[model samples]
Target: MKTMNYSPEHLTSNRHLFWIAAVLGVIMMAPVAWIIGLSLKDNAELLKGTEAVFAMPYTLVNYANILESSSVFGWFINSMIVAIGQTIGVLLLSSLAGYAFARLEFPFRKTLFIIVLFGLAVPEQAVIIARHQMFNWFDLHNTHIGLILPNLSSAFGVFLMTQFFRAIPKEIDEAAMLDNASTFRIFWKVLLPLTLPAQATLGIFTFLQAWNDYWWPLISATKADMYTLTIGIASSQTNFAQSEGLGFLGAQAVFASLPVVIVYIFFQRHIVTAVSGGAVK
Candidate 1:
């Protein structure tokens, strides 16, 4: 096998690229670092100026206060339930719909898919009024089901899974059929396991979207007990102008983002694989 040559000019180019990437990485990470610094500083000190973040006397008082609040835990639980529920619902519905669209012959199959794709064009703002009215009519406001049901119809998830399923070879399905496997069995036992990368990518995104969602939850879950983390944190803020509240707000932002950060850290490999189109055999 031939080996790559490392000429002087090539080495210089490599060094330049490395420094460029380093600078960009630092640029992207600066804001996150700043937020973390703000979270650690005392609220009163932060009120003087954000420059206090660079000074000493950092403390955990903000985090302690967050822990002391009873409602924070409730909000955390609500967020977890909604995020996990939406992720599972999106995975199940999207995978099933994808399988049908990719493998099965049915009436209006293409037309139906086109209509579903149209959902991507329609912004949620346009439908929020109608959706709110319908939910109000059904008295679904302030309920977990109300919050979850709206996001379950994920057009992007369906599209991603459909493309992944289509990339799978037909021969696998044919061989499974020769074994007299039922259609559902083929999908569940044979094909589904092969789509783990896509599932991970989709699940992560769905969970993040659901967890960060604020607007729908703000209106749908008006009750304190039903508030998800986003709304709960916002409701907790007394005033942005107050110095004491600034640190707490920064702490809340950091606290709310921890789960998403942890999730990306754990499943980042699968995300890379999915984006790189390595999900299919």
Candidate 2:
């Protein structure tokens, strides 16, 4: 067997890269570690600065207290409903629109596509006032439906799915059609599975956006019963003059992030692959 040799210069370069990565990793994790430490401290220990955060007498009572509070659970459920609902709605609507744009013949196809592309440049804040008025007119304010309606479609998702669908070979569509498959059958049974990576990528983005959404929900969900987790956690912090409240806020931050962290962990590979594939296409 032959042994490979690394030159002194190459070894030094590798060491530099390793140290750079280590530093970056530490920088990223520092805030998370601090939050964890803060969450463990009791109310009395919390005000003593960073030094006392990791000190003795760590307690889970902060988490317990929040969980026991009915509002937390209600907010958690509302967050889930809005996030899941918006993700599903975006996926369905974007996929259908994407497929039509990529594979179908329609009048004013270019004009319509340009219009869709125009939406990409429009900021959410630009239309928010109009959206609020529209929802109010529909009597959807202070409701979960109001929370979800604004995010039900995504321009980016439609663009992503369109690119993915366009990258797929036309032969597949022809073959399905030859077999007497209807358009919906071809889309559902043939094309859909092949676009899993794109779908997962889009789903993750849509879910995260909806989950972390605060401003829209703040304006829409005026009722306490309809508050999403982000709004609820933020509102809770106003009463955080007490040290225990600080620890509770830290705990709530960690709890709120867990779903998104788990989702990214599971779908990270697909996201990477889908993005790379799109770049190649």
Per-residue lDDT of candidate 2, residues 76-142 (tens digit): 9999999999999999998999899999999998788889888999998999899989998999998
lDDT of 1 by residue, 1-281 (tens): 99998999999999999999999999999989888898899887877788999999889998998899778889999999999999999999999999999999999999999999999999999999999999999999998999999999999988888998999999999999999999999999999998888888899889999999998999899899999999987886756655337777788889999999999899989777767867543
In candidate 1, stretches whose alpha carbon ends up further than 4 angstroms from where it belongs are 238-244
TM for every model, in the order presented, reads 0.92, 0.93
TM-score result, candidate 1: 0.92
Worst 10 residues of 2 by lDDT: 272-281
lDDT of 2: 0.87
Residue 216 in model 2: lDDT = 97
